[model samples]
Target: MTDTSPASALDQDPPRRGWPKVDKVWLALLAALLALAVLDRAQLGPSLLFTAQALWDILPFLVASVLIAAWTKATGLDRHVSRVTAGNPARAIGLAALFGALSPFCSCGVVPIIAALLAAGVPLAPVMAFWLASPLMDPQMFLLMLSTFGWPLTLAKTGAAIGLGLLGGAVTQGLVRRDLLGEVLRPGVAPTCCAAKRSLKPEPVAWRFWQAPQRRATFRASGLETGHFLLKWLALAFLVESLMLAWLPAESIGAWLGADAWWAVPLAALAGIPAYLNGYAAVPTVAGLIELGMTPAAGLAFMLAGGVTSIPAAMAVFALVRRRVFALYVGLGLGGALLASLGYLLWAGGGSAG
Candidate 1:
């Protein structure tokens, strides 16, 4: 028979302690990337040189990411984000999407914010609105895409991110009204992670660049942490990009996914569900695909789908929310990706498919 008393539980065991700070999954990922590098090398010397070049190309973005993270935290814009989303339903949803587009945080990084909002009694719909749009684009991503895909496609992609936010919010509003949110938040419970540790109290944002010693410390910590988080994954992404550019033959993407295939857009969207690529890394790879005959529509679809639902981001959501909410999140990501792809096809017309 098992002991069932509270005193028995105390005598039975104490909670395990001294957990490692580093995530094992991340270590495993690094190992996998290293293995790929070794297995796929065309020649040891050439591959090392190419990898160095790829790392150099991505270094600037890493610096920018760190700066942005620290600056955003210092300005306390996130407190405003919380305030906006907790307002009137219609207005809240619109503003949430708009704010989300401009947010500097990545999909996984934003998880803490989303969790905090729920803990503070923010509505599921507007928070969900922000959640759906936040990962797809940031200012850094926008400029990069503009330089790579040109003004037309880049603008359309940005528009699509906002549109998805609006659509997701409205749909979620309907669900909210009917009390059909499917346990997006557990009553009076906060997610157990970085979010649980941070104080979510609303504080006045200091406009001065270096308002206080503590603020400076916060900015430095946030920047360092954000930079460290981004660099490792980005390096892995660039490595994959280099490998694809080298090993993937011309016409491979276009051979099956060209504009001629009526089903290609939707299929590409589906493929992006399980495919993992960081937003920054996806740009060069997508350009390479275009050069190699991948339909522009297909590449864009992959970017949309994969950006919103990358493996790490999706896993973070799953860890925080209930199974039903996770399913809804995935559903929205796929639907949003398809909608954007179809919109692009109409806008770009026949010229993009070749």
Candidate 2:
């Protein structure tokens, strides 16, 4: 008989070599751009200072994410949330929207959780709702806005987020096909080995000397993970802030999205599609627009559309779900943004009339 042992397979040559013949020229291009960015500015001292300041500003959000993740893991909250989501689609959407409204997560930061939820058989509607709601509706952002922009803008933004989230959920449920969901429509099974290992592990003895070291080690590991996850985003936020501060022609942008135009809201929403800034970074930009005579309604619309709708998020959903369903999801976000913008305009107008 022919030998087909695992050892024989290990000894065989790989099918392809030299980085699998894939092109990584884009990586080189990015490296070149980074080199230019560093060299373009002579004040390395100031650059380092700015980077530190940016990191300090973002630290609270990063800390909050770590704490939330740890809490969820420790209290088995993730499991409970999974169970709720798996129980019923309608209830799942409500829970997800509420959770999204309350959680302190950026749109991009929430992607992994959303992916896990979808993988765990959470309905597409609720998953979509969470994705739309988490960035703008979170308590931190809401509270920050309340202080910075006052109660009116804060209330308007929060209402828009919740309304749009619910609308998006309904639209997604109405449009998506059951069969296209395939295996993703069912609840995920926990790994048997993980539970078994946890059961088998012995409880540690209470020793102060060892406890301090262990705690320190745990914190250090957590800090490293949080830094790794957030550093790039923090840098990107700084770059956007810098661009808005220095190069963007505010007068031109304002003229294009002027208050008198009927197309202003939709135009602003469409213009925001290419923008990658999250709510924290976007708040300052929107404030700048308001300073430039952009109406509060238009600014709110821009923030909503820009914060929730992103090319990357759309691409991730497309990769995971059916093409038709992906299209529906995109439509929900874009359409919901437009509808919310219109709703804001009508509500504001009605208030003025009254």
Candidate 3:
């Protein structure tokens, strides 16, 4: 029997044409360049030069980070995330928070693993810990931040990431123990894809990945894919940063985000929720703001708040969970950013209160 029905055929091989899509980051990059060319022709040349020089300066750190990420994926160490984070509830939450900060999973890559963890009956608290932390700080982000702001701020951000994760996990766990969190998953929801389901059962780690041909291929593929992703986002980020440096005045930035503004830390956190640039693009953006008189505290707050609530990370959480859970996620991100910023401001002694 030949089953040649139109619907069946379409299901087997979905139509690829007529789907309008564009990478937002690349689009922004192109639009920024176009705007510069049309509005300020003289500045265009200087901006391009600035972006190029900035990219060149960060190239070594970028390559090192990308290689490390690829190597982790190739060696299968990422699979141990579940194993290592398992055990006593408190212990699991702590381990999960630490892993989330250190792991190299990107916004999308982390989604499947998170979905799997929840589906496998892992408590929502620890998963929330990992979810909140994963996007905020990773090896790649650490290297980039170190290159831009030096070790002190970079380390501070890393600590904030872990602290935020722990806070979310603890609060969520308390809510759950009281049965206040209600359902963890959306009703009738299931894994969106096979990969999401498959992540529940990860393969064993192969420490000596080079001994296997498949692992070598994995290394090459992951490296190339990661390299392309990092390059494009970093390029776009530096371009926008160059424009910010050229156009946005230091006084305007300082007025809102400077040390003298007592409310600057909270304002930065709230501002970050709406203006969240995805994690990689944010490094240079915050650096530019810092250079333009934004206080270190405000910059850190913005980064933490933005990283957690960035569109991709928020969307991933939204798709898997109910409305209240999503709200909690946002609240935690905002609150954690505020606390971290206030503490840093007091400790750093950047400026006098207004």
Candidate 4:
């Protein structure tokens, strides 16, 4: 044992982790977690359990996310979708919003799909439409909203998602037509959802994706890439959630976003940008806020804002896209949230619900 054979020692050494250490995203997440850990331990809150439970709860979504990633790669559906829909703005955007509503994906979960669309040269308007709508009330989130809130709020959010999609699509259409559209995303930040296609040109390969070895490899690669990206962000988001829920609490949200104030709606939207968890996870908090006298209008705005621009989702978008596009995204999301709040307020004022 004392005879140190250099080759044997090297062989016994643990395999080094290289790429994750270098990844800015990974480093940022670790930093955030470390800070949160210190804060939580100091406060003597249920910080450890809170973080653990948050991750535990997110497991199901993670599995679904991986599957979505793999399938997106396997099908080459984005290419097919782009071929059918790219040229038609109205129809494509309408379809995108519709698809978003139908799917179970959250904002983060939709990143791979978003990447695929962008990589395939899908028009920004419709893609933005999908992006806008996907986070609001997907079928699963819709059900949760219904159970947590009520039919009126649920319908309001869904309609708002569609309306927002239309708004984004129209705005983007104008931008595209005027040749005023900036780059959709920076070149390098394009999410690595699949193997980079060396060309922007659409090359037709043999039919039947399963039969293609390259396609399978792409599927595996995309799934792993997507999983890695989503996991880090999700962990950060949940840690932030645990901290805010423990410290800020839902009752305070109602106080800050009370219906009486003219500024409440906008403030609600803005507050949601940093503090919002995913749409489904938001149910309990929203419910608490409503019970604590938060207006339905303010609640609606918060939900919309948080869904679109929550930290993890926004981070994913920012990493994958350019600044101008990112600004537009935040703009649309905030504007849409405000519109939803105002509309809901007006409707509720007409005595629509309890």
lDDT scores for all predictions?
0.66, 0.57, 0.70, 0.70
Tens-digit per-residue lDDT, 54-150, candidate 1: 5565455456645654655555544455455555899989988998888866665566566545544467888888998888888999999988988
Task: Assess candidate 4 and give its lDDT.
Answer: 0.70
Clashes of each: 0, 0, 0, 0
TM-score for each of the candidates? 0.61, 0.62, 0.58, 0.75
Q: What would the per-residue lDDT of candidate 2 be over residues 1-354, giving only the tens digit for each residue?
A: 001123233555678755555323334434534764677554444444554675576566656555543333333343344445555667767776777878777655565455445433356778887878887778878877877777777788787777777877766776554444333321112212332243244233233322454434433443344344344444544443334334453345545675746788887777555554568777777777776667666777777776776653443344345556566666766777778777777777512211
lDDT of 3 by residue, 31-133 (tens): 9889889999999998899778866765665676556655655665544554554557788889889999998764434654565465444678899899888
Return the lDDT, model 3, position 4.
21
Task: Assess candidate 3 and give its TM-score to the true structure.
Answer: 0.58
lDDT for position 94 in model 1: 94
lDDT of 4 by residue, 197-286 (tens): 322343454347667776666666666765676566666655665566667664566567756677877888888877756777677777
Cα displacement (angstroms), candidate 4, residue 14, comes to: 26
Model 3 misplacement above 4 A: 1-87, 107-109, 190-259, 351-354
Top candidate on TM-score is: 4
Give candidate 1 regions above 4 Å deviation.
1-86, 186-256
